[model samples]
Every structure is written in structure tokens, then in C-alpha cells.
Target: MMPQTTEMADKLDVLDRGSDGEQRSQPDVTAQSSKVSPLDVLKTDLPAGLVVFLVALPLCLGIALASGAPLFSGLIAGIVGGLVIPLISRAPLSVSGPAAGLAAIVFTGISALGSFSVFALAVVIAGVMQLVLGVLRAGGIAHYFPSSVIKGMLTAIGVLLILKQLPHAIGLDVEEFGAMSFQVGKENTFSLIARALEVIQPGAAIISVGCVALLVFWDKVPALKKLTWLPGPLVAVLGGTLANELFQRNYQTVALQSEHLVRLPSTDGAGGLLGALHLPDWSAITRADVWTLAVTLAVVASLETLLNLEAVDRIDPWRRKSPPNREMLAQGMGNLTSGLLGGLPITSVVVRSSAGVNAGGRTKAVALFHGLFLMLAVLFMAPLLTRIPLACLAAILLTTGYKLAKPKLFSDMYRLGWSQFTPFMVTVLAIVLTDLLKGVAIGLAVGLAFVLRESMSRVYEVSREGQLVTIRLNKEAFFFSRGKLVSLFEELPRDTHVILDAEAAPFVDHDVADAIRDFQSSAGLRNIQVEVRGLKLAPVAPG
Candidate 1:
């Protein structure tokens, strides 16, 4: 949802200029009027849709793995997000899909609840909540969530992703019987790391390491650098496929088995495409945890959608703004459809939406086409998709995790000072130790405390130079600040001259006025000189 636009104008400027670097007017998209044909739109949006499909394909697979969900769930989310949202949403260029950020939440939710079906029900509930939010026109709700707390949620998820994917990377995802029965979160994340190291699969480890290296240096390769239409993930998957083929041909002993690769159920069976249905358990709805999970999903997904929509607008070449309530309603329907059809929770993903824009997609057709591509892939490409090794997917997630919680993010938060840093750090630690909802609650309380302190602190300014002191009232001073006022006078040095300046203040509470008057009258006890500038105390009540 965090759509990045740093230096985007410079990158997009070349597209607006001619070969000679002379500027030209932007195309009048409506010049052709309503007469624009489907074929023309397909021609314009198809290639861009293909680009988005390539970009979204591997991510869907990888995010499903990261979330401990059936791989088809990811594709289902992609299809619904792509196909459904664009039909109703005013955000023409925003691409909705399964998000990397939600992986941690899904994994923990399933583990705590001990059932994917139950989790699916939670997703359905979340969709309903989003629909209600839309109906209430609560599009402005995103403004209420503190950015520091949100950043903390994401940073913790990054840490969780790295921890969660490590075992998969090393081919040590041996689930103990009933492990999901009591599993919760990163409390055991490191323990899994230790276990993965003990029984590492050489083939998977080698492939994963190589894939990570390739991703790290992908743009450095001269030929690959120019292939802007080709996504790095697709390249990594292709490389892994080729490497597996080489192993199959020559290294029989270490060739990765079927268990190490993607396990998409074949579409040619008696059930055909419908055979992959992993429907929700309706009985789980009565559980309190399920309700809690639903609320969390609804809130998080809504925030992500709103933020990504805003981000997409900033980078849109056409400079269009999306209607937030309509987008929310669209997301609600998308998630509702996805949940009913055995899919992961869906959100408007910044990465895919921004990628669509970068790939020259300017209309809703691109999103629709991308969804159709996902649906088709599941119907026909299951055989080829099953050959993709888990290690390569692991590498994709590792890169994603690294980017989400980069080292620079840490230093940047610290530089924002304690007001921002305290909540961010607290949220990170709490989420890592606990679950998403609990941690965010703790962080929000801390953030709100800081906000309250700041509000109070803003009412006055205190400065002292040697023996001279100044108390500057800013706009207003109330009863809550009387303790602060009294405390300030108590700190006076002997024979100090004090100036209580109220020129800027239009209203001073009677409590504050009384406190100032009492302080002024008693200053002679400490040989302190008290002068009130442009100030009048309230009339004292007769005793």
C-alpha cells in the first residue's frame, strides 16, 4: 500500500518527451470520444496487461506460500482483485491483488485458528466490514491510523516474512503432526531457523542462494537492464526451471523432487478447474478469534487500499484521483468473491498498481485483462507452474522482506525523534512478540499518549536565560496546564525576574489565571520579581 513516488517525475518525463528531448502535449485520451472500440482498448491495454500478469504471477504463488495458504488462493485473489475491482472502482489504473504485507497476518491467523476454512470465513467477514465502511462513507478513516504505527506493523511483517520463509528456502518445511494446532507467531520463528539449518537440502539451498544473488544483480546485467517489460521474478523462475532441468538431465542424485516444487492440483481431473476448491468451514463463524481476525483484516486491507490509491494518484500521468468510497466498495466485493471462492484476502497493492502505470496501462482494461490472464493460467498452465521450485519463490519473498524493512527505514524513524520513534519501535517489538492486533493496539496507545503530550506542550513555551525567565502563552492556556504553570514557578532561582507573557493568548482558563495570580503574589518569598504582561486574572470569588 505504501506506493513510492520518489524521483518518479524524472523517470516518467522521458516518456512525455520526443527523441530530441522536446516536450509535447499529453494525448487527449478522450479525443476519440465514446467511439473507442474494444479492439483498440485491447491493443492499448493488452501488452500492458501482459506485463502486469508477468509481474503478478510469481508474486501470487510466492505470497500464498508465505501465507501458508493453498497456492490457488493467491491466483484467486489476483483474479478477483484484477477482474472485480476495476469494474466498479473509480481508480482506473489501480491494480488490486493479494498483498505481500498480509502474508504474516494470514499465516498467524491460520495457525492460531488451526483451519484454512475458518480463515476463509474471516476473510468473508472482513469483506462485509469493508462494505459497511464504504456504505458509511468512511473513506477518510485512513487518516486516523498513525503512520508510525503502520510503519511498525510493516517492519514487523518484514521480520516475520524473513523468518517464516527461511525454512522453505532450505527445504526444511517439515510440519510436525498437529503443529498448526497451537502455533501462533514469531515466538517460534527463530526455532524454525535452527531446525532448518540442521537438515538443509543442498539442492534447494544452492538454488535459493543463486536466485537471491541473481535478483540482487539483475539490473546490473547490460542485456537484462534494458528488458524493462520483463519482470525480475519471471526471470528468476525461468532460471530456476532451467537449473532444475539441468539437474534432471545430469545430477540424478540431487534433482529436486515434486515436494520441493509448487503443488498446484491438475486441472484435467474429473473436477476440472473446480477441483481446486478449498471452501470455508461455515461452523467457525461463532468463534471470537475469527471475529477479531476479520476486524483486523478489514481495517488493514482498507488502510492499504486507501494509501495505495493516494499513492497511485500522485504518479498517474493523467493526474486523476480515485473515489475512495467507491474503491472501498469495489474492494469489498472483490474480497467477498475471493473468500467465497477459496482465495486469500485481497487489497489494492501499490507495487502492482504502480507497475501497471509504469508499463503504460492507463485504463481499467489492463486490470481486467490481467485478471483474465490469471484465470487462464490456472485453467491451462498448472502443469508448467507446478515445476517452479519453492527455493526461487523463497528468494522473491526474501527480497520483498528486505525492501519492506530496509536499514535506512530504521535510521529515518530514529531521526524523526521520540514522538515518532517510540511508537514505531514499540509496535515492531510488540507485533514480533505477539500478534498483529495486540501489538497495534499497544502501539496506538503509545502514539496517542505522545499526541496528547504534544497537544499540552504546545499551549506554552518556557525559556530561561541565567536568572531571567520567560513563560510565553501560545494562543490559549487551560485548567490542564495549571499544574504545569505551578510547577514552572516552583523551579525559579533566587532573586530571579520572571515575565509571564500572555499577549499571544486570547483565552486563559480561570484555573490557570488563579494559579498565575497566586504564583505572582508569593514570588517575594524567594526574592523573585514577577511581572505579568498583557494579562488579567479572573475576578476572585468572595470568601
Candidate 2:
């Protein structure tokens, strides 16, 4: 991964210079990068799909249980996300399914509706809303979110995952298992952590610690990196499962228990796939709750799909950018189909997508293969797969969570300034306290507040020893700061000499233009002499 990052940078450097017309080197080693053929794509995709299948297996069951849905609903969603997306998607590689982020929402909805059928209805409505969003081509609205906020969101997700999984990773099942809290109810993460310190499940804890260490070491080991043909998660999950079995057999210690099992519904044959059907709530369409859920689902699912698409493309050796709008349509179709079949709503998942890419997946064929594997697993390996411990899944999630919440991620955000850190930290807190959507809303609100506050603060007067008063826009001025601009104009004393110097303004928004237009029209009323500098009058676009 480290070498790959450097390689990407070098590729970007060369790609940026195409316009220079400078004397170039020989026929392209890099141009060949774009020569990925149908056969090559298929070969890469099939193995990649298998890798995704392994990772997705545990996740599908876990997420379905977390969402208060039938276990098979998750698998159904996974199959649809993996199988149907290739038809409409422009994304070279993206594996979609039930998301951890949406679990809380599903839980809340199920609790309120009092039935999985009602929740499925909500999902269907959400799918329709997403289809409408695709028709409107509003998927690009995600671009309006600042890069800083997005980074903060990703970082927050990482921290939340770490906190949520820590208890499970360390073998402590408290009141809140998959929780993200410094504190919650009478006890929080720290309290449970304190308990973990006192009464460690010596056997389970040891296995988890060993699993984490092995995964970390495997990533750093060079020789093993070549054997990267086998994904790190795959090794860790399989190894942990086997280790649990050995521990039970040898030491009479079992970390693998019924509560921690991936329960597969009992069935005689392949017919079980057809037996695992969920019907939607036909009456839910008339309810306001369904409408609300539809909007939320569409928004969250679309955002996840777009972000995952971006991340997958970044990891692609070929660096192909996915079309966001087209991907949105595919997701809508996938969700619709899945919901119809009594399955959970599907979205592009980073976990399996990363697994697929790491396993040398080059095309959508990998996703299709994964779906095929998932369908076949029910017929062949259902009983065996059911034996895999939930602790093993926790280990995989723990490893993934650590990568998100690494120390460097925090340092990077802090270095970016308060404008970045405020949203970033708030996002973490929000995810911990509430759920994903509410957390994101709170963080976004903070970011917007930061913008507005900075805009207002730019109005402070500067003392210049001259007849002319130099009005300077502050370092962080945006269009939303126009009220400050207007207020400054209003506060200017009669007959004052003034210079409006916007050279210091890093950004000028439409409100600034409006304020300027208002000032120019009313300059005579104030009896103030004003001179402007660095005023680029290009009309600002409405966001």
C-alpha cells in the first residue's frame, strides 16, 4: 500500500504534464495501464468476487440482525447490490450492500413500525426516491460538501467504528455493544473499558489480540505482501475462526458461542434461497413515516454509493473515475429490486469494495462472481459458514476501524485549522451520541456556522495612518459573509474616506456581490469616498 501510494503520485505527475508539449519518452508503459481487456477484467473480477464473498458473508448476517431484519434480508441485499449494479453503473469497480452506517436508522424504523414488513415498505419507498433523484441527476449535490467536512466525516466514522467494536474485540458485551460513546446511559465506552481491564475473557481476549497483531504484521511484511493474492482480512478471519475452534478443543475454552454465531436458517437444499423471501408493507406508501424514511434512505444511500465509488476509483491501478449520476441510478435499481424481494436496502460498501480491489479485482465481474458465490453458499456451505464465530467478524471490523481512527488522521485534521477540526470533531461526537445521519447533520451545521462566523468576523476595522480608510476582507471570507459586508457599509461614518481592498479575500461569494451592488447604488447617501481593489466582478453562481 505504501509503495502503491508513491506510484500513484508518480503517475499523477506524468499525467498532469500532457499539455506541456515537451519532448517525451518512449511508447507508454503507463498507456498500457488503460489497455485492460474484457478477458483481463473477467479474470481479475472472478477472484476479487470470491474475496468479497468471504468478507461480505459475516457482515450481511450481522448488519441484518443489527437492523432488526431477518438474517436473509442482508444476504438478499448483498446479492442484488453485487449482481444488479453492473447493468447501469459506469463504476469500473464498486461492491454495494447493507451499510453499517444505516443500521441505527433501520433499528429505529423497525422499533417504530413494529414489524420488518413495515421497514421493508420504507425501504421500497426510499428506493423510489433514489430513482427520482437519479432522474433529476442531483447526485452531484455531494460535491457541494467541502473536502474538509468529508474528511472529518470519514475520520469520525473510523473513530466510531473503533469505539463500537472495541468491546466486542476485547470480549466484553455490555448494555450497548455496537456503540460509539465516550459515555452512554449509566455506563459508556470508558466504563466498559475499565471493566475490560478488570475481568478480561483471557481466552477470547488473547485470540483477538493475536488476530489484530497478525493482521497488522501481515500488512507490514514484504514477502507476505507479494502473497497479497490472499487478502489480509481473509487470512485474519479464517485464522481467527480456526484458532477459536482449536482453543475450544484444547483448553476447554470457547469464544465461539451461539450468541456469537452467524445463524443460517435451516433448509434442506437450494430451495432455501427461494424460501428466504420478505414481503413489503403495501399500506406503508400512504404513511408520512414512509415518506420521511424514503427521503433519508435515498440521501444516505446515494452519499455512501458516491463516496465508495470515489474511494474504489482511487484504489484502482487504472484510476478510472466513476460517473456519480450513473452509479446513483444503478443503486436505485438495486435497492428497488432488493426491497421487492423482502431484502434490505443496498448501497456501495467500502469494506467489501476494498477487499475486492485488494484481491486484484479489475472489473464488475468480481462483484457478479461474489453474488454468485453468495447464492451458492446457501446450498453448499450454509451449515459450515454458520459455525464461524462473530468474534472473527469483530476482529475484521476492528482492524478496519483502527485504520480509520489512526493517530495521523487526528493530526491531519488538527493541522487543517478550526474550520476543519470543528466539523471533524463534532462529527465524531455526533456519531457517538446519536446515529450516522443525525451526526452528519450536526457536523454539517457546525461547518456552515464556521463559514458564517468567519464571514461576519471579517468586518473588524483596521487602522491605517492615512486619509484613506482601507477596508480589507478577512482571510476566510465567503459569499455567505455578505451580511458583514453590508453591515460594514452601513456602519461607515459620514464623509469617510475608504478603500475596499478584497485582495486579502481568498473567496468571494454571491452575497458579497449583492452587498457590493447595494453599496455602489447608495454610495452618495453615506457621503463616504470609497476606492475598491481586487474586486473581480464575475458573477458568483448560486450553490
Candidate 3:
């Protein structure tokens, strides 16, 4: 064979082998082996960790508050996510933590289960379920979701963050921090906003507005963008805290109270840390409710983690693929640890992962360092953290939400046509109306409906010229199309020459092939001459 033809054949052979699920051997010098030294990685990782720490700290507190769990629980989850998960996960840039998406589930589970400790037990059980799922190689299930539905999910999450955070931003302290569901506390998203409008605290509103403006300015201005070392959210938090302190000292009327700021349990030493940790109530293991919550948590957390891993991988500068099963295993271990230590259930979070990527995190060290920072902060700077206003954190999340559901994303989706746009919109609406899992389920149903409709409508193409008729079966002529096929066969004109062609079809189902053969046998009665081609005959039963 010619050299070019030989190369083409080799490439085809590789592709064929890949299709059979065979693992390809790598070169002696793998990508990771040739990477930078640990010292160089540390240089990049430390700064990135600081940025992620600044981003993660408030989210941890906020999500915990939203879940109706102890605020310290979120911190514990963050610590485990950062300190433990990275040690096992293959995704270098992905960051795991207490997820906002699970706040609603945690909140409901706690209420139903009767205690945080009981819910913690559920989380532990959920971790075991995740480990099982990983071992079963179920991580690939995430790939089955349509791209439009996934995008819709991200968009819906963004909208939820903005809507949920608005009350906090405007200084309404009634609702918990990081509530993502439509209904939070006693009020829904809309009612909460309406209530906030009536009872907006001037100091909180001012700080939130200023912080949001600063974040936007920092993001958009080219000169400000050059200062990458200083993350905008960190600046916003520090500046907002100082501004709040100033207001408290001078203008008491506009000053935010302690209730409007973060409240972390102070630790005096190792003894204090140990005392603060609440162990799970292992007695709840036998309860059906506990097992239900465990299954739900495992499914949701696994889905979210896989999706976040995919998103993070896409944005990684090195363009590395994360091992999804390994990620599941790591997350399982982290959640198990968190549950034992009184933390909220953890998952790979998009917000923190994206922040890590944008902050130039080169390795897992960044995540490890961020966890260390969380540990150190809780140990020494708990009082200082309490001074940071919730409004400032709300503002930061508002920006994060905007990035996820930007107007441009909607426009781009619309341009992709109705098939893509319809499911996308449905998912968004469902999520807005209900919750994440329900929304995704609704979207998947709609996407499948579209697929079925397409399949049914395009079963075959028919054309006629005088007495000559051609019926060309589609690439997928399956049993599902039997009804249409039967109708088309019956409608054939008398005394016409009918050609039933399946030569181009990759798969002609047994039922379809049988139908074609029946039509061929019956054509004589209708005075039609039928020529069936390329369909493999099914085996006949022995008389």
C-alpha cells in the first residue's frame, strides 16, 4: 500500500480498537512525568489557593446557613473537600466543597430526619453509595445527558444564585445564606425579594452595591484585569468589612448588626476543635428515610461532581481529562470523612473549581493549600471572619451567577435552533419552578420526546415518478417505526412498481425486515410489482 494509505489504515485501526473499549498504550514519557517540578508548582499553587480560599470561605458559611445545618458544618466540609479529596482525585483543577445545589435537600432532610446528626449519618451512607457507583463504573452516566440540558442546568443554577442571593445582597437577614431553591426559609424567591425591598438595610445595601460595582469594574477594565494576583472577591470582602466598620462607628442608623455578618464558632486550641466536632448518629442507619436521603444525596452529588469535572477540564489550560470514576471515589471518601466530622455532604463545586481555574491553579496543591487556609482561619481568625458582611458575599455570588447565566449564553443557545433551545428552556423553567434534580428530569424527558418524534417522523422517505415508487428506509429502521412502515406499504398504488430499498440502512430491525417480506409476498394481490432489496431475512420457524 502507498505510505498515505498505510497511515490512513493505521489510524482507522486505532479508532476501531478504541470503539471496542480497549486501553491504548502510552509513550514512555507521559504528560504528567514531563511536567514542572514540585517547587515551581507550589509557587503557582499558593497564590491560587489564597484566591480559592477567599472565594470558598463565604460560600461554605452561606451554604451551611442555607441548609439549616450548623454554620461550622460547611467549614468542615470545605476542609475535608480541600484537604482529603484532592489526595485521591485525578482532577488537578477541580475543587470540591459544600455545594449550594444540595442546600435544599439538606434542609429538607434535616427537617424530616429530626436532627443534624441523623442527616450526617445519611451523608455517610450516601458516601458509601457513591463508592459503589464508582466501583460499578457509573460515572459515564453523566455523558448521556444532552449538551443543551446540561447548559440549561448551569443557566438555571446561575439564575437561582442571583435570585436567592438578592435578598441577602439588599440586607434582608430573615432568609439563610446560599439558599438556591425557589422557596427558602418561609418565603419563596419572589416574596423574599419583595420583603427585602420593604426592609432593606441602608448600610448592607450600600456595601453590596459597592462590592458588586467593584467586582464588575475589576472584571471589565483591562488595566484592573492586569492585577490578577489580587482576586476581586477578596478585595470586595475586605473593603466591605472596613466600610461596615466605619458605618458602625460613625452612622449607627446605617450600620449592619452582628446578625448581618458571618458567625463562626471560635476555637481556642486543638481541644476546642475536637469539642466542636459533632459525630453522626449511627442509629439512624436502619431508617428508610435515612436510606432515601442517602440515595438521593449520592445521585445528586455524583451528577454534580461529574458535570463540574467536565466543565473544569474544558477550561484547564493543559486540557487534561479527569478520571470520572476516580473523582467519584475521592468525593465518596471526602463525604464519608465530612459526615463523621459533622460537615455538610460535599461535591465537586463549579463555582470554586472555576475560580481555581481562573486563578491559575496548576495542580492539586492549590486545593490542599486552600483547605489549610480554611483550617488556619477557623483556628485563628474566626473573630475577624465575623466582621465580613453577608451583603458582600452576596454581591460576589451575584457576579458568579451572572457569569453562569450571561445574556450571551441565552442568545447562543437560541441560535442553535429549537431542538436544542426547547429542552434548554424547559430545563431552566423546571428548575426555576422546582429544584435541580426535578428540572433535569423534566428536561431529559422533553429531550427524549424530541428524539422519539424525530425517529418516528424520519423512518423512511417516499418518492414517486409516474408508476415507479421508491421507499428508502432510514439508517435506523427499527420496530418503533413498524406502524409507519405498514401504512406506507398499504398505501402503494395498484399496478405500480414499488422499490423497498434498505441497502443504506445500518440496522433493519427484525420486525421491519419481516414487514418488508410480507409486503413483497402480498404485492401480487394488489397488482403491484414489489422489489425488496438489502434487508436481511429473519430465520423462519420450522413447521
Best by TM-score: 3
Candidate 2: global Cα-lDDT?
A: 0.70
- List runs of model 2 lying over 4 Å from the truth: 1-48, 111-114, 173-199, 281-289, 307-319, 357-362, 453-466, 470-479, 490-495, 498-543
Clash tally, candidates in order: 0, 3, 0
Which digits, one per residue and each the tens of the lDDT, describe model 1 over residues 15-89? Answer: 453211234444344411334456556645676677577657767876787789987788889999888889988
lDDT (Cα atoms) of all candidates against the true structure: 0.75, 0.70, 0.81
Ranking by lDDT: 3, 1, 2
Tens-digit lDDT track of model 3 for 508-527 = 88888888878877788989
lDDT string for model 2 (61-155, tens) is: 77787677888898888888877877788777788888877787777888887788877888887887788888889778767665555555555
TM-score of each: 0.68, 0.79, 0.85
Clashing pairs in 2: 45-366, 278-342, 479-509
Best candidate, lDDT = 3
Worst 10 contiguous positions by lDDT, candidate 3? 15-24
lDDT value for model 3: 0.81
